[model samples]
Target: MSEATHTTEILIVGAGPSGLALAVDLARRGARTLVVDRAAALFPGSRGKGMQPRTLEVLDDLGVLDAVRAAGGPAPVGMVWSEGSRQGELRMFDVSEPTEAEPYQGLWLIPQWRTQQILLARLRELGGDVTFDRELTGLAQDADGVTASFATGPEVRARYAVAADGGRSTVRRLLGIGMTGETVDPSPTLVADVRVPALDRDNWHLFPPAGETGFMAICPLPGTEDFQLTANFPDPDTVVDLSPDGIRKAVTARSHLAPEDVTEVRWASDFRPRAALADRFREGRVFLAGDAAHVHSPAGGQGLNTSVQDAYNLGWKLGAVLRGDADEALLDTYEEERRPVAAAMLGLSTRVHRGEERRGRATQQLGLGYRDSALCVDTRDSIPPDALHAGDRAPDGHRGGVRLFDTFRGPHWTLLTVGTAPATDLPPLKNVRPAHIPPYEAYGTGVFLVRPDGYVGWAGETPTGLTDYAAAAGLA
Candidate 1:
């Protein structure tokens, strides 16, 4: 490796959803960022294909939602088959409609490859790009910054570094962070992307376990002439064949379709479902996000969504501290607020994988929040339990002439006054957007200080403690 050194404000150690999302966020804020991926190119498989409602909102704020929506469609209804005969349709999830508070009420289906492409495009539009083929070999951090050495390139020194490098992360290993949890399912499962011109795209074809074989499903991928096939094996130690013929045989044996119907196998992999969380999210100047911090079963489609939200939670804080606008302590909240959320989502995914839970509102992630975090400051004493409070997701709606989401779309904190205005003097702060609207039931009567990640960081009947809260939150 070359002995030369390169520097950036932030070094992101993956180009997946989490790293790419963080790159986009930091780029938009004019923070110098470098995203490095060990892979030669973006991941090509259709893994993590489901986009939860909350992720759609995050993509929107990243300025790639239009492209994402145009490139994807809603998940199809499940069509079961048995003994070479078609069965009735099965609803995979409880259907929901868009509400004022939750504009994206249902799941969206876009292949993971396509989502990465969209994010890469948006990053380029913002004057940022990822460096491929750069594998992190070692990492060292001090009180001032982090230095990451690569296998084939010059070492990178950054003010901070984040590991979004998947479940078996090199960064996490280098930091000696241990993951704790259990194997959700011991049965090895095969997931592949294939082309089947004979398959209908309207429904996700499902085949129940027959005799000694396990279950299988073939779902058509939207905006492409491909389908994603998944099959389970009864034995945990069984070796999965990833060849085209193997995939064809797996489909032929499990489903009503013939091996010849599977015209092409684009990509394939196999894994046993597991749930694990890192012992800690941060080691000095290095932080872990996405799969590096937590692994899920992928049953409830929470892995990628939770991972992306981790980036959303950390991006603004990194930007704030790097830009000298906030105290470095703000960075500590990234793990504080996200670790519990990851743990809960892990349980949810495991339950869904075991058929003990349904893909409903919980899977949507719209109700997830950080109400109990150290950053949440709820000054009002008589607020109801169900009412919106500090650390709750700020609802999106149109009250008066301002659309709440539209106002919260950028990289800035928003002071939303609902049914009431400030009763005391406000502090001067940069990149903090303030808006006042007439009384709205969703927010009740108060001044809500919304974080850049669209969560209410502080709430009060008036602005008596708003300035102090802002200072403590690294906003003032």
Candidate 2:
């Protein structure tokens, strides 16, 4: 077979949740991207079963909340049981205040496969169709752009290439990035989807069967009469079995009931959680995002959520540099902002394994943000509670027909300036957006600037560093 020649404004390798989410983000911003996946079809197994509230906010921004809501992501009312002896009863739900900025206070538990389907559909609608069965064979990056080759297709020259592939990413290996974190044996658990005859569709149950191998968590699927359970079996050496007999035995053993109590088994799988992260998140025109960038124990179920956020963080930087809105320095912020987050998360995930540490019961929802970034100064004290970023997400309200984030637009020179300057007095930040904060003695409080992908940009009390801050934010 001969090689073909193709080019995209941006090239995204990996069709998993992160890559697809990023593709949609860029395509929505009018940046053309081509996503390549080695898989022939979307994986159907329920790999991950939850989406954090932060991720739900991202999906809402993409204008697909209704679809996600339809895809079995209802309000998160979950429970947990401890020790062992199987057969768990219902646990209490931790309720939180739901805001327009965060419509879903809890994780909308949905299978990973369904999440991908929703993202893929959105990508297609946005014109970022995935090229299936096309594996990235080789990659080479230069000062100007990166060149990516596929197994049986053409070479693609994109302004930048992002590797969102899984833990053992070929891109990471090809780029010679080292894995710095530890990888040890993780707690083994079994996950399955079923329809139990006697189980009702209300609360979650965790059975603490004896031997202390770990208990089983059983709960009714939010949208279906089918139920799901995560149980730790007695024999650590026993290979995870997905066969009907294996499923029956595992469920029966955990639920402490007869095998006949369960009928239809829709999904089954085994998982061992571990933590790992790439020593570097970027190398020239090639960058890493999602699982390719970091992998950690899913005890907190944060792998998918962090990966998606990584993509969101990188998407705008890439687009900015590509569209002449920002400079090369902007991309460096990816590693600076995200690597620390992954490290912090890895540490926190390790804590959950201790079983002795006590935390707020709402265990799965994560609140990872760069509020203390060196590049950002808290203008939160200056602003009232109604704003998006008192160093948080930029709030959007209706402006004419196109609901907008008031005076927020980005990819460069976000003049997060305060102190006496009228909106027009702000320096002309080419291709960047200017957000005006009515001056106060506290000054720019709760009014920090956010980069296009929503990380803290250059922040100061005096609305200072207008030019230097821009340079730090990838502006010329």
Candidate 3:
């Protein structure tokens, strides 16, 4: 047969959360992207179900927050049970109220499949879709671009390619990238979505380990009658059975529910907890993203959140470089900024898995930023140490009848002059949206330049160096 050929600006492997989120971001920026997956359909399991606050904000910018929120709900209180009696109530996440600066609070619970569906919908709305059953078998890159050959489809050529195909990433292995880390848990765990009509939807039912058995929990998934069941195996060599009868037996053996109560097994899978990070995020024009870049233990629910953050961080830089709006040097900051964050998150997830850390503010991921990156520039010398700095996430608030997030919603840079004014002859910056807000303490009365990804890129008491930074960074 003749070889079919296709070309695009960017080729994204694996239509998981990271790939889909990246495709959506680039789509809104008018970038050409092709997303491919080996699987014939979207992931069916509710594997990663927690959405951190920072991820919610990222989803808000992508125009899918409403749909996601509607499909999810706040994490329910954990109800502990002993035999057939109630033990106590456990708080799964540290709850906090929303503030003017941070509009999203607490942890939102949505099945991974639902989140992917929402992002896929948004991507299609932006005039892009994923190509399924395209298993990437070979990859080659040169000075110009990267070429990929699939098992059953056409040869694809793109200026850049990303690997978001989970921990067992084909592109990563093809690039010879090493994943260095250790097993967080030696014992295997089983995660499945099941339908149980006898279970109540008010609380997340939990059962403690008893004798040879292990701990088990069942959480009601919002917007559906299905419940996510997670069970641990204390023995390292224990084999998990994924069959419907096997799942029902496990549930009956652990909880007070009977085998007949488990009406249907929707989806099921098993794995041993591990935390690993890629040796590097990029090799030439081929980039590693999401679980392909970093794998985290599911204890603190950092895996999916960090993966989405990777996509959010890289999407804008790729779009800028592909559109000739920024220099290629900007791409280097992706690994520089995200690797350390990933390492930190991996450690946090391990600690949570080991019962050494609490899933509180750290797991929320709102405090993560690129403060030490080369792209950050802060000219103010006397500002308070606790105040927002140049590389921090821009706060959300309304001043002078202008909401900051509303101004920063699209795929464009934002220039906020907070209780400050530029000089009369200030140079004009291209593709930068301008907004004036009265002195908001969150920003500390300065001129802040926000990147397309919503992080403060440059801040100064005045716009003295704004134009120069913009021109040098290729944002002009």
Candidate 4:
């Protein structure tokens, strides 16, 4: 830590979904970014088997949706069973008309590993690379920049360094950030990705004939010749051999099938749900996002989706600060806007893990928002009583016949006109582009001004100064 001399606009630690997602944004903005991970290779397993539509939107922005779509199969049509009979199909449908505002209808069941591959491939395409065996061993943030030493012996000096590591993030620990939450011990379950000849296609059939040992599985793997079986292990301490035979035994024991009928074991592991978050997301020029910043149960299949969105919230702010278009204060919004979401996600994850239903949930879907945001005005009155709540994201509904998405892209800002000031009323900024729309004229489609990162800037009605909406975007 002797005043190491390395430099980059930004340095990202960890190559998980969060790190890679931020790298995708920063590199896209032409920010000189360097990403490092401790693992030599990406995770190779079936973790986070569900992908919500919101995540698909964020991935689409990063330009990897197609790759992920091609590599993975379709959204899971949720299933529930008790005995040999279907108890019910969890209501997992779009229920809304297709519009640019929000196109994806429900969650898809693609394993997390495929997502990592798609993101890594996209990062490479953007000229960004993740150096592995490179760990963040030390960090020191002064007035000028953040100096970090890598276990690899090299050092990096970045204007801003992000710790997207994980629950036990070395950077978060080095910075002395603490997470708050309790660990929920569900029945420890064994999950293995293997190929059993006659298995798969019943695709996620939860078994045990109602009273036996509940086991769920048949996750389809395209090129691989196997199924991913998830079963409640009688003993949490016992490790599943993960061999072909071990998996076959688990599958057959629960499904009452023939032993030889199962063949070819591919991969396996055990998992338990946990919910937690760092005491803070930012510490000087160094910050944290993703699992390194927060963790929650995989309930409602929100884990990966939440982490990716966390990076999504932080990326543009990091890029803007690096480019000198915005102050470091902008970075403050990451935690402000995302903390609540993560906290809510933790609850949703719990609900999902417990098999909760998702019907006409609420505007919080994508409607999750930030009233303290710089872009949102205080005209809370005009905000239809049914519109949204303080920490809720403004609905992606149409306003003034414009798509809330696609309309706001890249580094430019927009003036969301809803009976408030027009884009013409806004002052000149090198990157901000004003867009105005009337509120009453704007309904089901009210004006929802969004930043490049996808958080609400200003919603509801006319405010004194739209830039005031922007200043609060992060902090003063």
Q: What are the clash counts of all predictions, listed in order?
A: 0, 22, 0, 27
> What is the Å distance of residue 386 in model 3 from its true position?
1.4
TM-scores, all models, native as reference: 0.98, 0.82, 0.98, 0.85
Residue range 58-162, candidate 2, lDDT tens digits = 676665667878877553334433432323443233446664333456557777777899899998898779888988889987777888887887889888888
Q: What is the lDDT of candidate 1?
A: 0.92
Model 3: per-residue Cα lDDT at residue 225:
88
Lowest-lDDT window of 10 residues in candidate 4? 440-449
Give the per-residue lDDT of model 3 (tens digit) for 334-445: 9999999999999999999999988899999989998899999999887777899988999999889998889999888998889877334566677787888888888878
Q: What is the per-residue lDDT of model 1 for residues 346-376, given as tens digits with 9 covering 90 to 100?
A: 9999999999999999999999999989888
Cα RMSD of all models vs. native, in order, equals: 1.3, 4.6, 1.3, 3.8
Q: Local distance difference test, per candidate?
A: 0.92, 0.68, 0.92, 0.68
Off by over 4 Å in 1: 1-3, 422-424
Clashing pairs in 3: none
lDDT winner, 3 or 4: 3
Displacement of residue 434 (Cα, Å) in model 4 is 3.9
Work out how many backbone clashes candidate 1 has: 0
Q: Backbone clash tally for model 3?
A: 0
